[model samples]
Target: MLGDELIALLGDRIPDDHARQWLADRWVPRFYATRPGGARVVDLGCGIGESLDLFRAHDPAVRWVGVDLEDSPEVRERTRGDAEFLTFDGAAIPLPDASVDLVYSKQVFEHVERPRPLLADVARVLRPGGWFCGSLSQMEPYHSLSVGGYTPSGWTTVVEETGLRVVELRPGIDAAALLVRRLLGMPAFADRWFAGTSPLHRALRRHPRLRGGGPRVHNAARLMVSGQFAFLARRPED
Candidate 1:
């Protein structure tokens, strides 16, 4: 999560459609490349529940559950007719073991005070061959009550040390284009990252070498400038 003032300024710039687009464009193609179907997906730290709309309109096969520490009025209102929303005890999840196929979160890891237990739970709930896919801070100013920062290797190491295996790890952005957007004060441009609405980002998706992955994504030498760490890792099968 970013600072409050920054969120207040840029949140809406993150278009409502961007969430669904990011799902269909980025995460699903890679994480589900091996097991494609309506996965039992859980959104960890599901706040206002707006992410409930991230799935495709026609994909009713995908079951969604959101769990958070607070079941606020906003969260309740947004999830009124959609996914099941649960309130958690902050560390342990309530779901049955091996119950879900995918666990997703966005910028939620930093707020977690004890990541080991959380990751342990993630590993526990995920069905074998299931994935934990999402992004975390690599270069943001500490917000969301974060503990600290992590370089790309340090960040990935945290998850691997938890027992899950990293299958795909990448730098999250194309630096030159991002700089151009920031220089132009089109900070709203920041909202579309990894969602691939920008020309530069979209072009990356079409690359012959990068096909099947998401748009505006960079996992190569250019990753050093990215502000976040994005990855897909699976719970191994015996």
Candidate 2:
């Protein structure tokens, strides 16, 4: 994801209309292009299921499955209308090998104790040439379960080590908004409170001083503020 406009909140956080727009404008357009027609999609660590719901709305013919450690009513209610829910044992996924056309995750990598095994399992489920893309924290504040913080370089190493080729890796930030937040001494608040569509926010981020250097300067600011990393990767076709 590039530019401030492409930065998106998850479906669980945003309103349904915004979620739909995110799928139409961001998610579907990028992820769907790599998979075949009627591709099977599975989301690992799907928290409340709204992301899958939005994806389903866009492509009804695709098979949608959401997997997590616990299957709770809240998740069930959120996902029941459009998708199937499954719970896993925190290790091996229950699905058949090579059965999924795309496997997606977001903000879930840090808690994975055995990241290689997790990626191996993800690779197992994906068809050759299929995609697995998600966002993860590069430098976020620690929560109880938070155990890893990875740089873009670290992600490239981990994914390739697990047999997935990196396609795109970039900073996750509303660049201008984050800078404003940093200046206001409330970087954390900006993540939750910044206006996603503010013209000034977009303009400041697109300014020459920052935009001209490409992601180098953009990501430097992101890392200082504990921003995130967004990656799109694939299982090898061979």
Candidate 3:
């Protein structure tokens, strides 16, 4: 009948609106808990070192490195102390082979013109069993220097080509709600739209037919119409 009614039919297949499924604050804490105090982390396309700060907040001993295309004024003005910043030619990362334990990027892939070489470098810089994790746009509006976004399959293909196996993919906020926020000029209050508990999700949760499936089906159901997606890829152990 209605959109929500239709989705409700896919009971147990609906994605959860929790922090773990959404990869928010829950992720950094769990990641650092397992990592060594001096674990090496690289933030690809880091903008003003926000993720680095998050990592350091969890484990101050984390060796943080921020990488971007150029040393922009904003980065120079804001990013300082503790973390190291580096620039690359967009394809090859400047770090040494297998140097990092974690490679983190956030909302930055949508702007990249070429991702294969960059992903190859991601694999190169990561130590064996290291992780490449981040979020990417799927159906969000065009913003700063936006090129194009990737679908779930498209992203998996490229990551797999680099010989890194994808272990996780979670849908972010639904596309319809994200469009609404953009249409409203993305007010500060509208930032809650990123919290994963969109109207669609709440409706699904309310549906009498909706049951808890598993992360696989739950994620697929949401990714079908999500604005963005988060992923975790791992380099195999030697």
Q: What are the root-mean-square deviations of the candidates from the true structure over C-alphas?
A: 9.9, 8.3, 4.4
The count of backbone overlaps in candidate 2 is: 0
The model with the greater TM-score, 1 or 3, is 3
lDDT computed for candidate 1: 0.62
lDDT of each: 0.62, 0.62, 0.75
Q: Per-residue lDDT tens digits of candidate 3, residues 1-238?
A: 1234323443322334432236433456757766778889988888788787688788888888888888544456653666698888888988899999999988888988998989999999999989888888989898878799887777877889999987766778877877888899888876776764776655555545436554444456566677887877789999
- Model 2 regions lying over 4 Å from their true place: 1-25, 34-36, 71-82, 174-226
In model 2, the Cα lDDT at residue 64 comes to: 80
Model 1 residue runs over 4 Å out of place are 1-25, 56-58, 71-79, 174-186, 192-220
Ten residues in sequence with the least summed lDDT for candidate 1: 12-21
Distance (Å) between predicted and true CA of 100, model 3? 0.4
- Where's the lowest-lDDT run of ten residues in candidate 3? 1-10
Best by TM-score: 3
lDDT of 2 by residue, 1-238 (tens): 3323222311111122211001112545566665556778888877687667567666768788888777444444553545687888667888998999878787778777778887889988898988887777765556437787786666777788878877655445533443566577765656553324323434545666655544444443333333455667888888
